[model samples]
Target chain A: MSTVRVVCQQLAPRLGETEHNRNLGARAINDAAMLGAQVVVLPELMQSGYVFKDRQEAFELSEALDGPTLSLWKSLAAELDIIIVGGFCERLDDGQVANSAALVEPEGRLTVYRKAHLWNREKLIFTPGTAPPPVVQTAVGRIAMVICYDLELPEWVRLPALAGAELLCAPVNWPDAPRPASERPGEIVRVQANAAVNRMFIAACDRHGEERGIDWVGGSVIVDADGYPQAGGNAHRHEQRLVADLPLAQARDKYISAHNHVHQDRRPGLYLPSP
Target chain B: MSTVRVVCQQLAPRLGETEHNRNLGARAINDAAMLGAQVVVLPELMQSGYVFKDRQEAFELSEALDGPTLSLWKSLAAELDIIIVGGFCERLDDGQVANSAALVEPEGRLTVYRKAHLWNREKLIFTPGTAPPPVVQTAVGRIAMVICYDLELPEWVRLPALAGAELLCAPVNWPDAPRPASERPGEIVRVQANAAVNRMFIAACDRHGEERGIDWVGGSVIVDADGYPQAGGNAHRHEQRLVADLPLAQARDKYISAHNHVHQDRRPGLYLPSP
Candidate 1:
């Protein structure tokens, strides 16, 4: 069984507290590595926090991709022999900010992905990513990523799946939609459905606590190839770290039944490309 | 308000009892129409029954596209001034069989769609559909149909959504997976997730009762534009009929928030067509 240990760290990073957030992230990474996790994922904008008040506040909180945060994660990855994925506010050279996430490898190699689909107020704060997240080959599996609201688009996940992605990492700051407390949030449903369709593993790391007035729904989940929750599906409103063994190779075998291969059964002749 | 009342009929069809099954379906349609439903959906293979004993048995039960079942539905659709969508075992021209569904309109125009993805024993018995379901403009909304396991594919649902479909009719025979009876079935999660992602109404009609030792999970659901269950979510093991006002135009809008229009914000440059 070529199972890879995956971890999803659900932490509440205080707004504008970059140093404190960085410290929190370091502690989470260390804890996960000690637990034998080879891949550790963190929530969106954990270094700078989500829910910015205005443009000036967001600009002040944002930093370049080569800034202290990615460098710190890169060093930690090299030391621990782990792969880390996390989100941060990226300050661009052209005075624009991007809601970005990074994948840092054990060899200190780094690749950055900007959020392609921005949620509500994020449109006012950040530029939408021009390119999709790259799929990179790793010891764990062929891994790809989508940030926060990007998971809402079925096409975003399918793209990576077609490109041979076995695992999808989502760094999210999911706000609770108005619904009964007993129900699993819509975000959890999204991951489960997408995982089943793509026949892939998904590690969704979400934040907890209220960011400004917005309450984050802390249901960080790791779903297997069948869309069944492997660990910590309903994390609820608290700090939690979920780790599970994900069989990355099963995702490559798209055949669920004898005849139907998920991507192969697709009817492209009937579908038009999105504008 | 351009609200269209829709109904989902969750009725179990006894194996080989074709006439009885049609009667049961007729009764459900009458009930839905009494509740002022303009569109009514029924379970997969409700007329012929699912779980055939062998290839010979399945062939014996299969009927042509212009068979009595669709003829009956067409008469009822025109008589009641409603749209009907239901599944049947289809006997093809070259002696092949397809697990297919038909959408019968108020004008008595019939459109047929074969199930694109077959589950379990179905793969051995039926051919997978070559074309995706087509979206048709109607009084209720622009509607599309998929049968049973076809809903498992995100691409199948997305195809019709891109073509301006406001309503997706999923007629299914959802067998219960090995899980605790208390937990919501995975099939319900699939419809909810797909509905939420596509920003469209999904009326998923599922059968109940144990057919040939396979217990059907009867959680027929109607999800609105926001993916919230309008009615009959978790409709335990029994016969059920669900009716709800579906705001069809809301699906056309596709606007989740002021900044993000679901389909318009899609990044096609990053995505390749499904093979």
Candidate 2:
């Protein structure tokens, strides 16, 4: 099995600016493709920037499945022969909006996963999706998509991992927070932990720049199966592109030691049925 | 509620030296109490050391709940008016041996937890526990114990978190593995993630020393609710004592943001019933 070249394009998105954000996403994807990225990921809400003032504003900024941003992404995936995974604000029926991610394969297949676990004021603005994260089989590998806060939930990440996902691509808008002077951002740390525990590769794309008085960590990272970052594991706080060659086949081998396999060692019956 | 002073004594235990191990445990407990630690944590297999040659050797080193090491710990807890948590080789029914940890309270209450998930060669020697980790309400806080590799499973960690454990004390004997020079150990990273996701405090005590040609990670850490290490988050391969005054009350408030509580935000209905 060969390695897959994955890229995370971290860029700043203007609030409520649909066209500008679409252009930004396009440029990033083009840059990543130029850098030989077989799979490219963008930050969450790449279509309509994060931090909406209210539900009405979010709904107004949301777009349908066939919206211009997704259409452009599909066209780019086909034209560049690269898998495109990105986040968008979705306009659902009944006047509700959802924070969602779209994974577009070069073959023109599109799979969308709505944010299942809402964060902060998202609970007030967007209707949370009750479905699990989707793991799609692309030409490169078995890739999965989840939004920002969804990565915080290990059980949620386990869904795709258990479903045989080799790579989990997370589009995150990590609001900047105080951490130790010499420490990595907690958001990136959690991503590393998630990947390491499941023996899966994870690429998390975080946005930068201040939007409506809110800042981001801008901590994009591409971690291998062993949970070490191959590229971009710091809080650079700027528009940056991270690329890494991941042996997705390493994720297929669940064993970490001679007597232990990451997945098969789980004693699910011992876990509480519900929390 | 006031802060609880916790200590993780990362020490070495010589294999098959029962008497010497007991003396080492006693000295560590006394030293921790002298440093004003309300709760003390010790490494896994602290009583008999890790890396048994075979099942017979492990059984020979195993002890019951009334064994000398635990008896000494009980005396220390009562005498110093502090809680003590540590691991030991447990002798079980049917001529079996198990890797277990004991949480001894100042009130003379003893709670034992067998490791549910074995690591590497341990699968060949010990019987895996069928029960979940035990959470005990001590005078300082609601403390829980789970040995070594059990911490790798998010589901297992969630059991104690959901059971209202404020502080989870882990006795881990992490074997040294090749990691990036600048990156933190994956074991420590997972501990941070577990604490952050559950909004709980975790003190994992790891050992150091070369045992039967197997070196240990000696990465002991005390992490707060936000998953930042309060003390001793490094690969210090020697005898070290990590102390941190944890505001256990912070764990009670599970809210990371105004609209999100870590536990309440969980969508259990969507997760796979068994995996």
Give the Cα error of residue A231 in candidate 2, in Å.
1.0
Off by over 4 Å in 2: A273-275, B273-275
lDDT of 2 by residue, B62-138 (tens): 99999888888989999999899999999998779999999999899999999999999899999999988877888
DockQ of each: 0.52, 0.71
Residues A115-150 of candidate 2 have per-residue lDDT tens digits of 999989898899999888877888888999899899
Write the residue-wise lDDT of candidate 1 on B143-191 in tens digits.
Answer: 9998878888777788888888899999999887675455467788889
**Model 1 stretches astray by more than 4 angstroms:** A53-57, A273-275, B53-59, B120-124, B180-182, B273-275
Alpha carbon lDDT at B45, candidate 1: 92
Best by DockQ: 2
Docking class of 1: medium
For all candidates in order, the CA lDDT equals 0.87, 0.92
- On lDDT, the candidate that comes out on top is 2
**What TM-score would each prediction reach against the true structure?**
0.92, 0.98
Residue-level lDDT for B223 in candidate 2: 97
Best-fitting candidate, scored by TM-score: 2
